[model samples]
Target: MVQPLSDERAPLEGVIEISTGALRGETRDGVARYLGVPYSAAPFGDRRFRLPAPVEPWEGVRDATAFGPTAPQSPYAGALGELLPTVAIPGDEILHVNIWAPSDAAGAPYPVMVWMHGGSLKHGSNALPGYDGATFARDGVVFVSVNYRLGAEGFSVLGGAPLNLGLHDQLAALRWVQAEIAAFGGDPRRVTVFGQSAGGATVAALAASPVAGEVMRQALVMSGPLEAKDPADAGRITALIARELGVEATRDAFAAVDPDRLVAAQAKVLAGSSPLGGGPAYAVAIDDDLVPVSPGDGLSAGASSNVPLVIGTTTEEYRLWLVPSGAVDRITRLHLAIGRRAAKISAAAVRRYRANRPGAKHGEVFGAILTDVLLRRSEYRAADARAAAGAPTWVYEFAWRSPVRELGAAHAVELGFVFDGLAGADSVALAGASAPQSLAAEMHGAWVAFATTGDPGWPKWSTERTVRVFGGAGGGATVVPAPRLDELQELGG
Candidate 1:
């Protein structure tokens, strides 16, 4: 599937036509790669808080090697910089897409995977290391990673600005795919949208959005579910944050301010955290026009129940965020503050977790319990809700521990593995030199399979059955975690 880069296959010299205008991209690794491909017009100036407008067609091919400047974002440090260069192109036109495809020049259709990066809606870009689409393209898929509004730019709920502008950016990208994918050797009819973390959450929103009907047919939401701040509550939080910015609590007034200044105010808000303790005060509002209401509710109500779904979480989904190197000893402290158990701590809930690892340390128990409570429970909730609505849904738990940090299958660890980009330092260190080759093959293959066909080679999950457990010796199985899910959800997580 790896086609040699050729003159004929490269984007027409200085004039490859995109939906908006002509673009010129550089060729690399036997693939014609296009960077900074605008999917939506600049969401700045007066357009700052409005729904994305169609980008004006340009007079000539625009260079797309460097990615556009990221939508006003604050760096969410994790190893992202080492994983991908934090090179920011100075521009307000940040909503863009990157494409990588084979180079045979033939005008044939290929499967497409539109990827959304995970950063809790605060920070991340499509132009990251582990996300490079060369491998997927080599594997015969047209790969696209997108940059939507992030943090305040994408998720801050301003009244005058379009709610869910990040989601709107995604829709714009999908519209571009429908209009111009054929030029990149992609099939408009066979598109699969996939994402992790907040990106996964966005995918969930898209699944439930009516506008998404003609945008994508299949979706894979990795490690994100339909649970979070209620849209109405989210709006209230944004208005409160806006008040902190000394701006009137109205969208029009907020939109009149500079995007960078608004972003800085948002950063201050995130830094301040919420006195109410709901994490940062930024995310898509239910916006009756764009998001209607709860995306999970919509999914369960049969709005997008027909869309094929592949959803899963890591075994220790929250371990990355919970048990940090400097924080193991802090578990007992948190437990004391939040109480060791949920509500009044009924005997049944205690028995559910305590009975399994009888001799485990308090910290271990807390970490495990926290992982189940916050992460896995939400994933199960989403899967169960969708399945109940008649949507074909697959659920999974990635239990492959990182060999390097011994981080016990923590958050974002499965990303490189699922993308088949585990040769890097963190991934190789955790997965080992060879790591679990079969696990990567199985997981990545399943992703590709889901993209190619609606089915991902697993039975659909339901209240009676769940499928896909990437755990055990080499870590790959398709089975139900019914008891674990029931136990975790019962804890009121």
Candidate 2:
């Protein structure tokens, strides 16, 4: 139970009763916010590495004014820290949900959008200022942001433990929304689950998950990696981490390791590896029950056929990693060789990328290539699969180049525009002060439209392969045939 606020601030919004109990949400700028509402019990001690359990009922109104404890994570040091500022309020109740609703939404059912944050499934929290859902709430949507376990606590495939505990946390939160969001003026049947990076991948997994079972009506994946580590690869990662901790790769041994030490060891093991190698080292493990097959294959095989999807990636998604880590200038022929081998692309494909971007540096070329293989190609595969399954799919490419450091439409750049929060400090830092407001309005509107009506004002992705491009000279959006399809196909295969 949350301690009642002691400050003498004026009473904000009146209380509303939910399934668990009554909550008095604070009001801000015409939106009523119920922050830090626990959706699941604390995952610690015996519950560590186990599936999430339901939150127990509480007496009296609980205070939902402040942000809850963030999932324990290491700080985002150096360039990553500056680029992606994350808050680490260590606590056990990390599996919580925050809500933003229109003040006048009591009498009507609003389309619900549940946001899952991205941190490579390692580091991130919903408390980030950029994730504020007030704008969505004010726009007649019930917006929810959720927190789940991260890193070892969330993703480690321990013996005698459930796989994808973080994902299970997400599923539990969605169930909570279904059972409780109506009290907050949300339509449970119209839920749209959208996420970026790891969260985006989770959106894909949830769509393919048999256990999810109609929890979401639509899904939007932004720069989500579409592949999961092979079970053998996951075993290797588990063994490596276990060795680092000097413990057996089992639930009992890992649960005994200090969470802080375990996180540090996880970081140390991943350090100095290539982006592709590092990300998959801690990626979603393909499990028989949670994820029977890879999202791409499952979608192709008609999983989640009834759920419409809006999925795409930024034009320069890799710059987010390459530029920040200074890997852009450090690429060598050896690195390119490894990248080519991993992507299984031919020399002609490499030449095509180089020829397409004249005067590009080696690192830039390599970054672009990695971006296509790691991100764009996955999106294409998923989109293609959905199209083939006769499911409605809309594809987009964020092309708005940030004026700051030529970060040209890199990964996570489209987030601010999607949330209509270009003015946020984090967004401005990456997108520059002159980032287009009109473009944000358009992109945000499209997302809202998709959530409300399952259409983002574009033709479905079919054999024609049409895509909506957001960000041009005057910040206007245009539908054009997908670019570089031949090269992307070669890279994807």
Candidate 3:
């Protein structure tokens, strides 16, 4: 447990010395904020599409009062973009971390929680307005959010470049935290790395990484896919994009393309892809050197089994993509038949879903199948495997429905509550203006509690598969034994 800070709050304006140099930070809302601080050197020029190089030592205190440049990427397009907002700050120095520390918790070693923002391995950054870390800092924790390489720049398996460059960037940031967070009054030993969607997948992989020992103390995966692709399968996306650019699939060839042009070609190649059906999309891949095995295989088979873990999903994840695009309204019965075969869903299982979800439309039912197939089942299997391995694991389900665009308890709907950003405009874009604050308090409090102590105020996953449910038809947070066990078993089998 973190010791309480003295009643006297530390002065807000201050300079903290990290390894590279001293950084001057600003104060606001009783929190000390150091924004856009480079944890690694800019990955450009000779270093483009390569492992992150160390940040060169600076001469004077770097101006860190505002957010730094974000990784190169385009905005989320069309209707989905409307709900999930993004920032595109241009620059070569894109490997940065934004930090918020409690001014009142000075001199005390507060637990640190580092955030990984999710963007499907393509979009997102530390500069998103709703991702402010002040709330965690206010609650007596030092919070840090990281930005890494994305899309081809980060994930592509190239001929002469490292695999998982984005993941490597994240590891570098964690190493930086281990070396520097102490000066910010943080306990590096109590670090908890947590994230949503792709970010969640990232932490899962990190937990199983052979190098995870000294850097991270805990792991949390929220609605993140746990599968890692085979190198050849993963490289196919890069090959397609390279073909789109009429260039060879190699580091030198990709490095020659303009960053903007590469992402544009990537978008065009993936325009027809969807969560349910599509060609290869960018994802974490299995590499003999780094991710020797997939996270699910690693976690279940004892990799990082000793690490405390919290993994879960929203009730209706597929709605995030399906509803916004009018696909739900357009789904036909024939489409359901084809999806069942493609996703390997048994006819009996489809019948069960139809019966259980009485009055549900064809698209809604099919969407549920895709959600189970793509997301929910992955978390379920990971939790079960962790249980068998005798690891401490907590499972949760975010069931809060959003009135906006009928995105009921969708993939990222719980983000507003988790970050306690109901009043923020970014939160409003996804969740309606009247989203509940009580749920936010309960969920956020549970997270703070988990980071402070290994437990999330819920029973550990075991024979019962207990889950902490947040905001469903049942208004308050509750824990249920083996929720949806039968349905999950059918999907898994």
Candidate 4:
């Protein structure tokens, strides 16, 4: 009943105080934004590859008018690059955070949402215009987007260094939010953390962590994998990168290599890897303290069961990987067989998908099957487990098919809508010129509602498995009793 960027008030707002000192940001369209605020110490010199350290206290109000550097990483390669826009800022102290809040600042203490972006744990930053928090701030929420170490410096498991440094960095940022968000008129107790893809997967891992209750009140995992690898399995990617750099797979040896060079090697080693057959890609690893097990397994086992959660996937997540690269066309019957075997998909699942999508090519069928195995099914199992424990969980699907590139509700297409950043160039690159504002409003409103009230205007997931389908055929939103219940059930997730 009651509510609520730069594109639409004034500029150069005022100062807000925190533990570090003071920050001066701008107010545009009634939203005050503090950009490029450091939440951790610089990870260069002797600190490289170590756990995130506390930020040194400042002497005066630091200028937070511009975004800080992004984590060291490479841009998307090939056709994927053309479709996904990336921002690459330089420097070693990339552990930063961006914030947006209502200019009036305080009332009931606005609901807070912290964003972790998805880029295979190697790409993306809070600086991207598409990740801007202005819209969220305008809607009565204090929003944050965090930049953590990535690639070798963050995720690479090495001798003499902590594993999952990336996740640890995020944990540090959350701790900072809990301590300092009230300065920006944000309620520390009402924090809701959400992310897409790799970011989403990280959110799941965090939800399963013992410290989850100390930081965030809720979590939303969007189009993310649910698996965690053992140290040996997860470190395989690091070993390959070390081999490429001609060094021992240890913290000291990698500390000598330039971040850009390591990023280049990361791209080279990961090249030609498909979504299904991508051998040893970066993923969250099980550790004794942070994430003790895979999120899917841990979550289904009732870890973090008290955390209200929302989990969903785009209708065609794999199509984002397969369609633009022309890989979809090259898929054949043999490829399907190998994929089915590797994914453990049953013959019944294959036949079920084919029947559901009549006249579908082999690539289409394969993409559908791969999406379920790699994404949808695991999330469903997590939700089902939480539901059985009497925990509140909600499910939804981004079904709006993008006209550009025939991406049918593909991965990341929902992001522009979710953030209400459809006009942003990065979003338009995938969603195209003529996207729908009403649809964006619908999805964005739901996320806001979820953050504000823990109810996204939809039924809670239960034995019924109700899912709200957002912005597909006939437009607007619809609540359905499991849109593809038969196919999903047949898939045996």
Candidate 5:
């Protein structure tokens, strides 16, 4: 439970009164930090599987000093846990938002950037240390990170339940920011919603949502999948979970089941599932309410047509999954055949990829194909659609290889640099000890600049297919022609 402020007249150091109530924040290094501020009511018991409800009003100033309980998730086992640090405080108060603002607002309405963490839509929490927003605050921006439901609690497509509860949770958080961020010296009009991976996909989906209206002024999608799963696909996963749990795939049954048991059942069902080739068991569903169509198609049809966008993926996003798991060297012709079969791409498509990287190993070729099919191709399609619809779009590719483990600009590598959080050990593990500080400065500055103004210090992506490549072998960022345009076109980008 949130602690109420004492009635005794103590100095109000970092108190800000907003719509719900007053919040007392903590000050650190010239920045005001407010952690675990509830944006919506907890989705447990009677509210399970329902759309997010408004946060109930609270009395007095609530202490927002400590991180809130993260949504329930299965623990990451072994080295994966070390590589991606997650916070898993068990409790129901999971629909919370963390804010980092400059200590001295001075009546300036700073541009606001809302970050959505990525964990394939099943894992992840905002409490991760690397997601700390003090750097953005220090750089003259108000940064807000949110925690939403995950796994079965968030994405299971139960009968008679509202679909995409996690996305709805995000929309609720955005609404909260729009209504109340001004108290923290943030401009509600200058909001930029940005995220990587699943969060990135959420950003795109939100932009395409009919309810978005003028709520979001801009968006940035980093390594987020653009294609949403069909409703039938979501149903299959729900049925699979239901079969495993020995219950009906309905909201009442799921709500009655133990939450932990449901989470464990979801893990078991998804253990052998592959996210490649549109096989995500739990992801954004193509529900007409929140996501009316494929995000790519919506962008083409002028959904959020006025919202500018920054969209891109890492140069080798698949390496993050393949390299650490020792699956790269083990990939064989059978694996390629399976991937090709799943994606329904022709042998000519495989030949094109192989020709581009002459003498590449079958595993390397397989990883590249997955990277393009699952990430890069979708990014290109979304960007092209948005640009065609007259929304200014900036495209980029993070090409910096991790000096630590040859991770080669894998998915989520640019996160530390984006947040200007290279000092953290978790960050160093992915970015390497000798990661260039200059690149972080440049990339972070560009994000800030984009939030402030609708440009990211590069020419817009047009028919020229221009992209800003950050951190190549020589240790500097560059603006270059986008590689694999033909491959993307072949993949129907």
Candidate 6:
């Protein structure tokens, strides 16, 4: 039998009662335990492939002790499971949200931060050890992490189904926060949406969305921005994959297959076909109603929110993707493809990239090229758009090198440090044996400050002002030359 939950957890909007559940936590100061509270009901059955329908109200307090099952994902079937624990639900209708906040009774609202996890829109889980919100809660912010549709379940395009259903799921979560966060000691008016990679790109899309603007107040994007695959391209990709499964492109055919079988088929199709790599399958699609247009197009057209923004990318970002493992060859091939796709790189810039690293091998250039093609140029462009849109923006580059062998400030490295929880399981790679307490303090404090106030204790990025070079000499910050920025700007242009 489910035990009765404490009433200390209040209902958001003064209408929905939020029940309490237990949480496991440990921060720099010490260890502390808390609870996971549900703001909405589990999405299931008829709601699959549609917007997150409102969860039916429950009469008695419900137990939110454990995290809800993760949205479904392709099972790579390996030690990856031990590394990343995903709570898999069988249905395509998977929308669940989890919140971790200080349990102590509060009379006032606290600042809110909603996190969107990243998996190239294919795989990610809110239950990852790295994403635990206890540290953020202990740090005095009401933290919420979300689970949206993933892989084909969320991204697949069908005429009747909601395009960009994943995005809609995010919007639903934000709406919940706006209506109910106050009951959990969170200030809805001061909410900030942030994410990494796909998550970051989602935030950028939200910034461009009129509906998301009404719900969100600010944003922090790490390594992403708005831009879904073209609809025709997405449809063609879906068709090709559907054909592989002996299923038609119609919704009825898709609905007939088990979610696991569908995911397995998707993984098979992705392995054999280089869709996004150019054969035609695309992960994100232009859902005009949800996304309207590509994020790049939206920014250029001045269709973005004017909220404060904080955007940053790590220094050795490429190195993360080109580890010494089996990734070297794949990295090289992807880089060659990037060189082919690059439409704006001047011959001079290409020469410069090569000349700067005269002793480097084709492998290194390939990795760097991929970084420039996918992350660097996109990031620079997003900053440019934010400045153009008249939003208060701050752009920083995390240049801190890692003590680890080759994962220098790798993907998701800054996460735990920024949350002030560099002691978590996934964070072990970042903190090292002798973790940089001071640097973590500086970084964490800046994020907390940003969540508290509109500013991050730094000058804002403007069209006139370009980039902030974090971890410069004298342990301070510096600005990049405008001409250099202009040169990078040409890539995105």
Reference-based lDDT, each prediction = 0.71, 0.84, 0.87, 0.88, 0.85, 0.65
Off by over 4 Å in 6: 1-16, 19-41, 75-94, 105-107, 272-282, 329-338, 341-344, 403-405, 464-466, 471-493
Model 5 CA lDDT for position 41: 92
Instruction: Go through the candidates in order and give the C-alpha RMSD of each one to the true structure.
Output: 4.5, 2.8, 4.6, 4.9, 1.8, 4.5
lDDT of 5: 0.85
**Residues 405-456 of candidate 4: C-alpha lDDT, one tens digit per residue:** 8887899999999999999998898899888999999999999999999888
lDDT of 3 by residue, 94-150 (tens): 999999998875446999999998998989999998899889999888999999999
Candidate 6 lDDT by residue in tens digits, 117-214: 98767778777777887767777788888888777777787656667778878888898888877766788998989898788888878877777667
lDDT, candidate 6, equals 0.65
TM-score of each candidate structure, all chains considered together: 0.87, 0.95, 0.96, 0.96, 0.96, 0.85
Clash pairs detected, candidate 5 = none
Model 3 TM-score, 2 decimals: 0.96
Tens digit of per-residue lDDT, candidate 1, span 1-493: 0122355545565346655566667676768788888878888877777788887776545777776677676654443333323435568778889998877656358889999987777777886676878878877789899998877667766556666778888988988899998888899888999999788888888887887679998888887656545566777657666777777766677777777787677666676342122355555567667677566667667777777888777776655654444344565635633655443544566566667767755566666665565456656666777777787888777877775455677777787778887786545544556667677788888888888777888778876766577755445665654546556755764
Task: Please list the residue runs of candidate 5 whose C-alpha ends up more than 4 Å from where it truly belongs after superposition.
Answer: 1-11, 277-280
- 151 in model 1: Cα distance from truth in Å? 1.2
Stretches of candidate 3 above 4 Å error? 1-13
What is the C-alpha local distance difference test score of candidate 1? Answer: 0.71
* lDDT head-to-head 1 vs 3, winner: 3
Candidates arranged by lDDT, highest first: 4, 3, 5, 2, 1, 6
Pairs clashing within candidate 1: 160-251, 403-430, 404-429, 404-430
C-alpha lDDT of residue 222 in model 4:
92
As a whole number from 0 to 100, the lDDT of residue 37 in candidate 4 is 89
